[model samples]
Target chain A: MPAAEGTAPLAVILDQAGLDGLLTAIRAKGWRTIGPRVADDAVIYDEIETVADLPMGVGDEQKGGYYRLKARGDQALFGYTSGAQGWKRVLYPPRQKLFSAKRTASGFTIDPMAQPDAPLALIGVRACEMAAINVQAKVFGDKDFADPGYQGRLKGALIVAVECTRAGDTCFCDSMGTGPEVGTGYDIKLVEMVGKAGVTYVATAATDKGAKLLKAAKGKPAAEADLAAAAKAVKAAAKQSRKMETATSAKLKDVPEHARWDQVAARCMTCGNCTMVCPTCFCTTVEDVTDLKGDHAERWRKWDSCFTVDFSYIHGGAIRTEVRSRYRQWITHKLSTWHDQFGQAGCVGCGRCITWCPVGIDITEEVAAIHDSTKGRK
Target chain B: MAERKRPKLAVWKFSSCDGCQLSLLDCEDELLALTEEVRISYFLEATRKIEKGPYDVSLVEGSITTPHDVKAIREVRRQSKALITIGACATAGGIQALRNFKSVKEFIRCVYAHPEYIDTLTTSTAISDHVSVDFELRGCPISKHQLLEVLNAYLNGRKPNVPRHSECIECKANGIVCRMVAAGTPCLGPVTQAGCGSLCTGKDRGCFGCFGPMETPNTAALAAHLKELGCSGRDVQRLFRSYNANAEAFRKESETHG
Candidate 1:
């Protein structure tokens, strides 16, 4: 076995070359490395085999209905905040086949889908994203009935969390008490410091798997000065301008008739973009498909959003017919009833819901309206 | 207990580019298999061997622009058990319906040297306007995968497994960047139905509303946002007046603008 993480080193320093070799080391050990890469005009999680694939000297400006990549003018890696996509897709894929059936003599023969193979090592995960993953864990696995695909993929995956050094215009993870610092559930926590010495990461292993990988990278022991700078950077990142109040978690369920929902609904396109981009919003519906000849049939589980009118369909018609009800359902369930169902809030303050919304409906601004109004009523 | 027979299928056309009907033929692999599943009783685009109707399932394409088209569609409906209209023409009156906003008589005078010979309706209309359509498949040229699903569902005696959600969901699911939000392109995805596989958006251009209005789409909200994105009155109006222009929600939203 590998040495214990604590016994290995308190922290290690990884320069550019060390970081490049670290990726090779990760892949050499049978881990398919998935990390942030610039694609589709945004930094999204995709297959990454080299450190060069990382968005170096890059930052993003994000706001409600806005995301733009800009040159950071520095070699600092991990300088930007989280993209619209998160690590949720890694664990729970958008579409997965449940099983398939072929026509048999009597009726049909069902064949279950094969379980996932080739374990993944997620790189450059943010603190807010980690919280979202934890929230999903509670939602998917904590119950008596667990999502097999999600549980299987999550159990085998390795997490490489990155501390935020920069906050976007829409980022409010600090307000949610989940971000700007690596809290827990990470194998290796890396903090990047770009200076005259060059881009060096203060990498700390949190598990034996991380330690073994860190040893393979062969990075130098971290200096006290560099460690202090990394800590200061994280603290500065925590001092974000945007903040959201968690007071809605206790009150939003009771006040469904809140007029703010109608106001938000007017601007809300009900496009379902917010829910799709949200890291913790895990809802899927099954699609049963058959070949043209009807000889073969397959069932696939696909991503579903509550914003769709048919989502609440019954025998008679749809329950949430009006736009107001759908928006109300989303916000209320995300903030309040999700706590009732999963023992935690659905949102992780990642601001994806805000950034990706067509009309720029900030969840924090919506919550604040309710939080302030409800608090004033008493 | 009685023996079962294969579902007799038919294909009919009216005023269209025949692209939607061609989508069925584009299913090269599935077409041969489709032939085994249903009798091709009336697809002239494929074969000259004409088979009479009273078809179990009829796939109708194009709009009812002329009086002859109106008469022929009712005859097709009378002869078929389940009538499913395919593409924008048969479902939402196609690009030809742009004349619905203007005078066809004046257009004939402007273009046709012999204006008297041109016999057409003043306004184009969908097949459902005249008769009760069993189902309507909306698209400029309907997706073959979706077409197969519709046929497969109809065969199995189940509701078609098509989603009534917006095109925004399709774009997001496919991991295509939002052209409207990210690039300031005036896409109709938020208000348009989920189909066409985000073709325009995937190409980094805005959706032209080829798939028509989705279920309970907020066109007013999307239109207002489009205006905020620097679209003028005409730009917003023209954005909805594409392949699925004459679709109800789109037509109403277009009327509010230029």
Candidate 2:
């Protein structure tokens, strides 16, 4: 493949040592490195010391609503689907302190809390995960009311995205247009290549920050053949994905009030696991914790979900008291109404909601039902 | 001496999970600023601060289930200038309204350790069912952005720009490919109201109707499609009788299947 014109070509083919060198270079820069690691029955994102900590030679078995880890025949370093965790855990965080207050002789003196750390490097991020991050950035950073905490944490984080060589059955990034290939908004992108000699990686710098990092690593410049191999890998991943094709935006707006929502609601436990695991879900609730001394009070912000009943309370009563209404609110907001607010789809097509949903309610099937019925409306 | 007037804002709770009230406090940065704009009169969730009403604006959460609640709501109505119901529990009777189908006593016995202690009414009803609601914000937990929009609108004396369209409109505007058409997946985006912005559909999942019915929802047609996709009649009935079971349209649809 020919390089795009006018863009400086910064590419390298790294052997196995290149992986360790990359992690070493990131750590040497005083930036914390977080990636996928094995933990209790599933792969979770955590801090890493070296390349050895990464999930090597492992692929995930994912279905319509199920996900599991399995062994890969080849000892490949980047051969897995997305895990239950996303970068949101580190960037947004599950819980954080907002402010602390104390009563003084004159009045109350409230001290605001500082945001989380900066300059964290996220390695092995997928295309879908990157899309999720962008969606969250809009929610927490771009709007009229920006979340200071999220803004502080995301300021200088470096993203090292990896292109998927294969997709799981549950994968639908292709349908969402988020990915099998790394798109814009990454610092560095990596594509792993397997051959008779050994496992190697073709790395490319997406930004000036990425180019600066690549200058430290010693590797051969990528040949035209290498870039072609990377493109082929991305295409294969896309092909492997199970396609879902409804005019998602149009159907969501057109379908009339339907009983189909009741079908999924009947099995939905409303446990809120889906929202908890979602990468872009930023809704939260606050709690006040008063110190035993009674002079100081602290407030905390924690993640909240629309699936919970208390989320919709009113003076006379709850607006959505039934399971169907709650389910309807969540689905519509994600697929249809999110556009009006954000000018983009709220979902990034990661399929985390499907695999993590305890009852395995599939979103693709629900949209198809609506499309078939609402075609006339369109 | 001249007196400073604070906008009296009352936070009232009925039958809910107490999540929407949490959204107000969830405005950690804005919460302090908000207090300066309005008086924290009757929020039981945040503080023990209780102030007498004739409130400027009242934010009520949860549903009315018992006979006592019916009378309490009337007093709330009388005391507030503008009333807004937040979340699914307040706007649609919430998931607890599942009891709208079966005997309330049986539901109580199924979950409670001491059913006798459960002094509840047979049906869990929404705020609008009993009294006039100025505005209704939809969501199991109303979107904080939408909540702020409602507050800002009322404070400015203007109509809130809440959408009355379906979820399908949001999905199209976002440019997300229809998951159901491409993958044979069933979705509720067509009939459901827009608020969630097609979050589930973008994630490759179907709409579950957490926002409630759209303005002119055609649930029967969507139900027929679900039947074609292998759902049973019981499935159709159960679908409508969910979070908004007590809602007029949803309740009527479920009755048709039943």
Query: Highest lDDT: which candidate?
Result: 1
True contacts reproduced, candidate 1: 0.70
How close is each model in CA RMSD to the real structure? 1.9, 11.5
For candidate 1, what is the DockQ-based docking class? medium
lDDT of 2 by residue, A186-207 (tens): 8888998877788999999877
Worst-scoring 10-residue span by lDDT in model 2 chain B: B173-182
Query: For candidate 1 chain B, which ten residues in a row score worst on lDDT?
Result: B1-10
Residue A98, candidate 1: alpha-carbon lDDT: 90
Every model's DockQ: 0.67, 0.03
Residue-wise lDDT of candidate 1 within B10-111, one digit each (tens)?
Answer: 999999999999999999988887887788888899989877878999999999999898889989989999999999999999999899899888899999
In candidate 2, stretches whose alpha carbon ends up further than 4 angstroms from where it belongs are: A1-5, B1-258
RMSD of 2: 11.5
Candidate 1 residue B12 Cα shift, in angstroms, is 0.5
Model 1 Cα displacement at B190 (Å)?
0.8
